[model samples]
Target chain A: MNQQFKDYSQVVSQYIGNLPNDGGDWLVAQRSSAAERFTELGFPHAKLEAWKYTGIEGLLKQGFETLDKSPEFAEHAVLNQFLPEPVAGRLVFVDGVYQADLSTCDAVGITVGNLRSAMAASDRTVLEAIGSLSGVGDHGFAALNLATVHDGAVIRVAAKTSLEQPVELLHMATKSAEGQALRSRHLVMLETGASANLIERYVALDGVAYFNNLVCEISLAQGARLTHQRVQHESPKAYHLSDIHLGLQADARYHGINAAVGAAWSRTVIHNRFLDRGASCELDGIYLAGDGQLTDFHLDVDHAVPHCDSRESFKGILHGAGKAVFDGLIQVREQAQKSQAHLHNANLMLSRQAEIDTKPQLVILADDVQCSHGTTVGQLDPQAVFYLRSRGIDEQLARHLLCLGFASEVIDRFESETLRLQLTEVIRQQVRG
Target chain B: MLTIKNLTANVDSKEILRGVDLDVKAGEVHAIMGPNGSGKSTLAHILSGRDGYEVTGGEILYKGQDLLRLETEERAQQGIFLAMQYPVELPGVNNMTFLRESMNAIRRSRHEAEIDAVSFMKLVREKAASVKFDQKLLKRSVNAGFSGGEKKRNEILQMAMLEPYLAILDETDSGLDIDALRTVADGVNLLRSPERSMIVVTHYQRLLEYIEPDHVHVLAGGRIIRSGGKELALELEAKGYGWLLEEAAA
Candidate 1:
């Protein structure tokens, strides 16, 4: 084998060697499957259309070491310091492994446990659905995550259960003296008529180089309502790759908000499939990039049935020498008549050196569907700046207010008040920095 | 209280206000009536310290200081307020927050205590009601989606809240209905005092009917062609600016 393939195999072997005996079979199978796919796909290059804007050349140059399970790392306060007080059914993960003892999962009529325990339990419904949703054929990191993910979290909501508070999933990565690679997989299923809000947060501890590969799959049954928020605030030395796949049944409502603020190199892929009629989905995102950071988002919303509606809006604020890319697609199948979809992507370039690439697309095979897409990239409005400055606001405060206003439209859509406020604070610190 | 001597300004290399000289003492109201492209708005913008206007000649003095040297915010802190012809809509910025920021900025410049939220809200509510503005407008974003009349009323409400020593109204009655015009004029009239001054710039003399300027000036081709008492506005309104331009050319 070549050096690259050898390195990949060594990482997989390290993760598989550490799996507990109780859940060794499932871990071995998943790791082998993922490794085989990784060997076939290898690292993504500019040749791949989805990875066109974000080439993984630098990530491949330095092969990252797999991180060991460290429950003691949960003692770090960076997660709770930035987040608000924990809501109900809160789960915390340290270095890719779930920390169930420190989490709370009461009053939701749902079960939340570590991925290993859930995989070994009598109910194998969660494991059966893993990798069942297609469309990962071209995504290299997603296939790699499926191949080697050992422990994350599994959450299942029974029928007709309505959660009073949002479930918080905190993923913390603490880098040791030697850099490490962390992979995790999360599964979430809401049965018929179940309603809940889920917030997944990722934070990197200390200032060391690391790589994180994460995959999250959510299944919403008939009449199920779910609001999912993903916040990425890792250290500047970290590289993060995440994929989110969602499937919605009839009359299901799904709302997802992503706030991407930190990391040196980060890429997020979001695939949402509306399988049944009358289902609605909305995705709102905000990304802030500055200095040497590179942030990329690839999103696809599939309307597989008739009368489904979807709206996608993502905004970016780029400063210094940072670069950002947004590729959003809305697809309506031939049989999906009467479908309605809208996609808008806007970016604010705060510095002359900063750059943004936005591509909004619509592909509809149905004759009776309404679809529209738009993209805008520009600097702050000088007239608005003068208007604010004329009112006695200084230049810095005026610019700050304009930037805050730019992000407030997306931030206001957050379902959790605490998360909203916390995200606002994060955006403020980022803009001020 | 304000003086402009030989002020020649250019916007984008095209001269707009050429050798314009004007003076207004305390306790006086001056109305400047001009035709289109006659630099009426340019003068208002220049007096308010807006950018993009190159003052190639002369200087403006306000309260014995060189006003031309100050930035827009500095002029604002010095109690100079301009009611824009078309108020820019600032989405996501609350009206109350904008007002409180302006008020406190001026207060800070004058070494006065800043107004807290309660006091500021109370002051805004009172001033907003005086302009007959709906309370809901205060909660909405600054001028976002406001009707023409509502936008003008919002400008007047801001004027009342700021209570500037020198207030310049730039076509404040352009798009208002009769009721809105009356409310806006009433709001302006209520704020007039012996220690304060105003320069009302408009294309027509209709607004002068309600506010009643003490002096009227006809500005043509970037200069004040004629200055007379309040009756000058009536004569100009009756005969139209075409006759005045003809007379000036003759």
Candidate 2:
């Protein structure tokens, strides 16, 4: 009885029971095994070492119910705010269902479609890459996402092909998802010498008090390059969790940026693994946590090959009673010599109640490896504010400018010019108060 | 343009400016020379509306308005500029954006139409060239990794851009080399006109050689002890503040 401690695992089992019998038989078997894994893992609690700083007790208390049948959604004009038209490729998923009518996918040198279709068609790329890399089992969210995920975007680029325009996948939660759990999975595969850019955005259209669990797995072959950008603007009353796994082969380059500006309680986990030598990864992120918000970013970069480099920098602006956590690990194997990796997390607290729990670790087993991890938790500099104020900038606007300055370093690295300007303005509005 | 009626201030309960009195007319350049430990910087800071100083007594009048009532930025919008001895380094902040935002903030406060990017760029380039400021540096973070001389020159460049009516140079020559000093002085000289007044505070007379002041005052024990013309600075250079201290004591 003591071993059978009750948790959300039973609730998730009930969800798996009601899951629709769709997709290929292989997916049903995969879902069954994932459910088994979830039963074994249960749910993450503060007692676990990795869950020491972030506690999902609030998420558990939400009593989320998974969609029993296909969800119903009414497209609102507000969705247009997230969907900027004229995109090269666009996929919109609402309430765990992909809307083909709302998507304009140009599958010229690539395969871009939703998971259910890819799974029904027995696409080998999607079948092999879905849950292959998120194996650390650090948390139960990945397994839950796998057990119930019905729909998401799948992108596969052929060798020697470079995408001229970026592909965007927007996941929106609608009224039917309110007080319910939504699961989605994405798989991106780049062949040798292939290059493409993708942007994944999670937004709350109408639903509040919903739970969004997502897993995105990206694999790149030799000499491949991919730029992946993620933005989370979930409703302030929603709980969001995501796992982004990256596997890079020889000479592959991966550039990723994660922007989190909403969600009452959110945690983003980024796992990077280098399969061969000469691969490099640059990951940057920024999160704005307002009062009553808890935003956490967890990262793990595994360097198993020589001559690989990785740089991870995440910044946060915490105001009012906001709290944040940044946990990053950079590990270099014994043979992974000449590997250079640096991880930095900087947070600015606007109020005394605002807090941050940051732990950056560098595990170097190779003698010749260059590895570093650092964290900086600071407040608005009074001297800097005085300097700006002396230059005729009011105190309020001075603080706002300084806050924007702290956030722009990462925001500027976002790939698209329009998105960069759009995100900057959004950040400006948030920091203005 | 400015008047100080026996202005006194304290820092942490210790008096730094003890009943200092000064008056400056439009177009006049007043050099406030003092030895170390005097309240030269204190007076400059008070006039610029910097915090951390308690106004123990006395008052300051700028254009007949109670200067103490205005905020730091308000004084700036009202045409008061202080070239700090140590300019605060703001990392991750684009210097060009900082300048333009500051310029527009002051302009908007003064009921002047805001300057657009194109015009601001043109004006800044012209002023930056006049000050010998590297245009490349303007694109970098504000004062981040700037050499000592570059920082001072950047300050003068900002002063030129803001076009302040009353400017205070607080130890502008402290860390400058000869060439840097000349460039800064030249920038300052270009901004000199009948509509503007300046207060140049320095410990050495090196800066005075290039930009001659109409009146020179020796500050000792937190108050102006002596006031004279440009020849007074030459006299002080010939014989350090020892003679002036003795004369003031006598």
Candidate 3:
């Protein structure tokens, strides 16, 4: 039984047939076209320029099929760590299906609920926003997510409202989905003058091999602001892929951070586009890959309007035989004058067998723009290590301190104190591992 | 407390410290002054057991133990502290953390209990105050973004905190104004005790004016050619090192 030869087209059709028709003909047509696009494009491969460094052969060989029904999970308590004490909202999903009994939505100035339920009432705004951005660039993974996603979060913040707490979405997988595929889709919209903080975390209850594809579409109206943080701590045997798309209007701001501490092979692609003028954004990320794991972060920022600014900083600490890849591209169009954009990628190879491939690409067509990009891949500074050792710190402890210090610059940028401290512990464990 | 006999060392396959000899007793301060390329700093590094300097000849004895046989940390644990000529900046390790860890390392080697955080904080603050060092900077990264004078002052602070038996200050007055030099000298002067010895390595006699060394030696060609009392420093300051280098060669 060859895994790669199994037919996946039937699974796509079956997923589409199982979806309710309450969304009218428009959603049906959108899903049909998305399935067609996925079938045509298929899974991304290393031959593709955008994914030249990462190989998806292992993912394709898993022979994944959409999990039509939620499977039984005995470890319902696995979502405890992700559920902070004083959160504005919490949504727990297992295998692309919302677990209603385990979720709570008590936030003010916001409407948070299951995506499928929100879409069933023919919410034209929800459908239009989801359909417009899901498969915009013909990305195969995004198309698959749009075509097969069954349940996720639908959050809308009202205008001129500010939330004091963060909304968290916990996406977990159980061992029952060993050979199945999970696709989750999220739509977050912020109206004019609205502000909120959103956190999305991924975890796995068991160390089983599965394919998880996620797609999130975000829209920020004029004068809106959103702080988004994404954490991926999947099982070491899991294959994870996420596509995040963000659209910013005039004077809108988006501060995003994507961090990954555990995964066999995980990739997060973030695409941010400035649709109006005076929009600014800060995109920063950190990845700690150990024990032969692989992590990648791909970012693309488009400055289509004038007076927009974008800053990106990414760092990776790779130990064991782990490997990491970072590719960031900031593009400034002809009319986007005074666009200040800087992109940087730094990697600390903690072991001799660890590897990293990083590139910071800048494409500026405007003459009055300030754009720069740089990449650094090196081991910890030997001089700094010796400095600590000379102070009587052992060589191993010195190395650990240097590695942690190297990672602190990126970790300290998170505004949320709780998340920052949690990620600090995660980084410490990775360094010591 | 310290003795080096015909100590020959090489750096990068080139002979740097060739047949150097020096001796210092307890409670005494020895000042080794020399021109450039005279291996003044090399001797300091050799005593502190820094890597990349191969000691090809001779031996160093501290308290009847072979100092060259120990590792850098081991030498540090045995109460040999080297205040670097150019201190390395560590961007992530906090100053107080480094100080506490160093102190614990020394204590652990001596089979003593490690100090707790509260007591360690008190100790560091006291030592920092004695050196006139700003305690607020201790919360920042170790010597990161510190000025030259501040780095020198930090070295003195470490000396005060550790209270080593043999303290070697290598060019601690370099790149410092008169005021900063006085502060650093005062810090070093306060650390002097009957049970401790110090080696002041410098290029000029200005620092000696404040610390008042007991013995002075002119180092030329990796060897101490002239050894005398504290008056030798005044003579060398008046005549400069040109005559000493020529006389040593002759």
Best by lDDT: 2
Error of 3 at A247 (Å): 0.6
Compared with the true structure, all predictions reach lDDT values of 0.84, 0.87, 0.85
Highest TM-score, which number? 2
Sorted into a CAPRI-style docking class, model 2 comes out as high
lDDT of 3: 0.85
TM-score of every candidate's chain A: 0.94, 0.94, 0.94
lDDT of 1 at A322: 90
Candidate 1 regions with alpha-carbon error over 4 angstroms: A17-25, A69-79, A82-86, A120-123, A134-138, A175-178, B111-113
A1-433 in candidate 1: lDDT tens per residue? 2687678866766666667667534656766766777777877778888878886767776578765545445464634543565566888887777776678787758888878776777456866777766434356677777777767788889999998778888877675523667888888999999998888888767776778888888899999999998889888878898888889999999999999988889998889998899999999999999988899999999988999999999999998899998999889999999999999999988999898878888999999998899999988888888887777777777777778778888888887777677777776677742
TM per candidate: 0.95, 0.96, 0.93
lDDT of 3 by residue, A1-433 (tens): 2334236667778878877675443467777888888777876777787789888877777777776766778643555556554778888888777888877878778988877776667677887888565453357777777777777799899998898888888888787778778887889999999999898888888888888888889999999999988888888898899888889999999999878887799999998889999998899889988776889899989999999999999889989888898889899999999999999898888888888888788888999998888888888777777667667777777777777677777777666677778887777666752
Q: For each candidate, what is chain B's TM-score?
A: 0.98, 0.98, 0.98
Across residues B168-247, which tens digit of lDDT does each residue of candidate 2 receive? 99999988899999999999999999999999999998899999999999999988999999999999999999988998
Give the per-residue lDDT digits (tens) of candidate 2, residues A1-433: 2233244566656766765565463566667778778777878888886788788878877777776556676666435755453556888888778888877766577877898888778887677777788752446677778877767888888999988778888888776778888888888899999998888888776647898888888999999999888888888899998888999999999999889998999999989999999999999999988788999998989998899999999999998888888999999999999999999999998888887888998888999988888889989899999999999999988888888888889988887776677777767776533
Better model by TM-score, 1 or 2?
2
What DockQ does candidate 2 have relative to the true complex? 0.83
